[model samples]
Target chain A: MTESQFPQCRVVPLRMLKPETSERYLNEVVKVEGIRRMMVNGPSIPAVVPYGPARGSPNPNSNRRTIKVGDATMELRVQVGSITFEVEDAGVIEEIRKVTNAFFTQFPAQVLEGKFMKTEASLVDYCRYGPNADPSVIGLVDPRRKEAPVIIQGRK
Target chain B: MAYTPQYGPGTSIVAENRRKQMNPNYKLEKVRDVTDEDVVLILGHRAPGSAYPTAHPPLAEQQEPDCPIRKIVKPTEGAKAGDRVRYIQFADSMFNAPSQPYQRTYMEMYRFRGIDPGTLSGRQIVECRERDLEQYAKMLIETEVFDPALVSCRGATVHGHSLRLAEDGMMFDMLQRCVLKDGVVKYVKDQIGEPLDREVSVGKPMDDAWVKAHSTIFHSLAGVAFRDDKEYVEYIQRIHALRTKYGFMPKEE
Candidate 1:
């Protein structure tokens, strides 16, 4: 099949950290160092857009934040690769800190340490049928640290 | 120079002189007398009310009606008389002539039997010829017209039994049970409709997660959204633990 036949999905590079480092230490370092560097060097991230109606019942006590863009609703959940930070309203920055902390905690003494090289984020739209909502997404975001190509030529 | 008659004298004398020159001893042997039985005659036998007698009939033709079996043996018929009769009857059916109604059916049958009309031989050739003649006979029979006996030539052997009849029977069964049944079209329509409705409503829940994950550069660059949920976090943790323990890394594409 030709390339045109396939629907393009995001592909990104990831760097996993050693397990010796502490999550607390990694999270502190990432919030101070990593986020600052990305904000300074990289382009600004796009705004969050809402997708659709909430299908399931929202948690009563937990702050259920939903952002609306057009016909979509956005929900926030905190994930850190392997470790999750149960932060209230843990937006994109907090989510990044959690992932960076997990990475460093997982891998400690590597040159490309304490952070993932890249990641692919997809915007899923889900439908609610009673308490059970199906998980489906539309747009995708793929971010990666640029890598230099290594060239090797045959000696004639 | 002037031409002159080579022989000069009476005409009979000149003729005798030419004969003598042609044959020196023209009448040497004396004539012999003929007996009654020795009187050989040309066109001798006379038939009644005819000028000349015809040649006598052959020995077989002259033989008596109840001639001994050994003396006048009959030709053994290769195929049974009944079979020939049936073939004749079949030929006289409505299947006579190159009609479009049976063309497809016959061609399919021929193909199934690996019979090529262009290069028919052995029994296949014979069967095709027989079938054609039978079709013609059928037409004649339908029109109530009698035809002369058809000459049977040696044809190629058509292997296997009457599979055409069996296939026809199967087709008939299919037409009755499946094609002609009610609600078949509706059932097919329903199968197509359900999938379309289900597809439109897909993808609502995952939209929320995407928005939450990529809200800022920190989350997007750090790749934290990959493990945004509890299940994903657990899965990643298991992978990390396994990798740390085994010194194995996730396979890179």
Candidate 2:
């Protein structure tokens, strides 16, 4: 297992602390943020996701609308012996940063140094244009489109 | 073929002849005691080896009984006919008595050697004794008093045994002696090396000093916002403060 296989999130070193404690602290911070899910690199899984009640319905249902947080379908990939994250949701990128920052801030004296690096394409690509597509809803158009513009969101 | 005459149908001829030759004066008697001379003659006639006279010395003359064996013997006192009597030897009462201190002393010796006294086999205990000289010296040092005779014999009584000034002193002596003899200490040592004398004030956080020491690190890190939102900034700060105040640093990396 290469280090790059798991998405390397910027983490502050807390002196002499068990890895489990840091993981737990990070988890708690992410949970409180209403951002229910995120992902860490290995196994290419999503840590969290929001499942709407109208998921199967043509119209959105209010009752089943719930946000699932944390790694769900994140996979760790090794490229050139370096661990890389295959993130399912790009939105979780911000949450990972927040959790990492929060963890370091809790023990600033222990943070020797840290760095943030973004790499690898996301597994999930959101389509911006569809049958009922609103121009405002469309973000990025697919670069490969030759005819009509196909807007898509690439996860981080 | 020529016919030969058969014997008489009635055996009167043979019977009549045997009766004519018979002498009816033969007699038999049971012998109560046979002398050496009689035995020699009997052997000389029956077998060649028997002719070589008996080599055994004459039996010792029996002494006249003070009371007749029949009169003195109580037939019902012992086992019944065909029964066997078995003798079982036990340790001397002085050694085996419940009140005897030897068992306790021996057990203590075993404990020092790291052997459980109750479970020690005889051979193990004997082995322990061979290795126990150093234990004896240690015991003497801790005890502050010595009596070789106390350990030498089972029946020797201890006189005027007094309690030592310090209980620890006594226990230490016992432990030392046991280790010296047995090569192991069985009991747990309870004493902490240093005395805890500082007065712990009520309502004060116990680890306040450690928290204060790491406050700079906590404040700086806690101030950073991973989420652009305002709520997470406050939450991270609170977590930082709480951990700094009360949580112990993890022991391992």
- Which candidate number maximizes lDDT? 2
lDDT tens per residue, model 1, B83-201: 12111111111111111112222322332221223322111221222223333323322221211111111111121111111111111110111111221110110110111111111
Clashes of each: 41, 49
Q: Say which docking band candidate 1 falls in.
A: incorrect
Which residues of candidate 2, in runs, are more than 4 Å off? A1-7, A18-20, A29-91, A103-105, A109-156, B1-253
How does residue B112 of candidate 1 score in lDDT?
A: 24
* DockQ for the candidates, in order: 0.01, 0.01
CA lDDT, every model vs. true structure: 0.23, 0.25
Question: What is the fraction of true interface contacts found in candidate 1?
Answer: 0.00
In Å, residue A153's CA in model 2 sits off its true spot by: 23
Pairing residues by index, what is the TM-score of model 1?
0.13
Cα lDDT tens digits, model 1, A1-156, are: 111221211111122111122223333433432121121111111122111121132212111223221232333221111322111222544455444445444233222223222222223222222222211111112122132211112211
Q: Give the least accurate 10-residue stretch of model 1 chain B, judged by summed lDDT.
A: B186-195
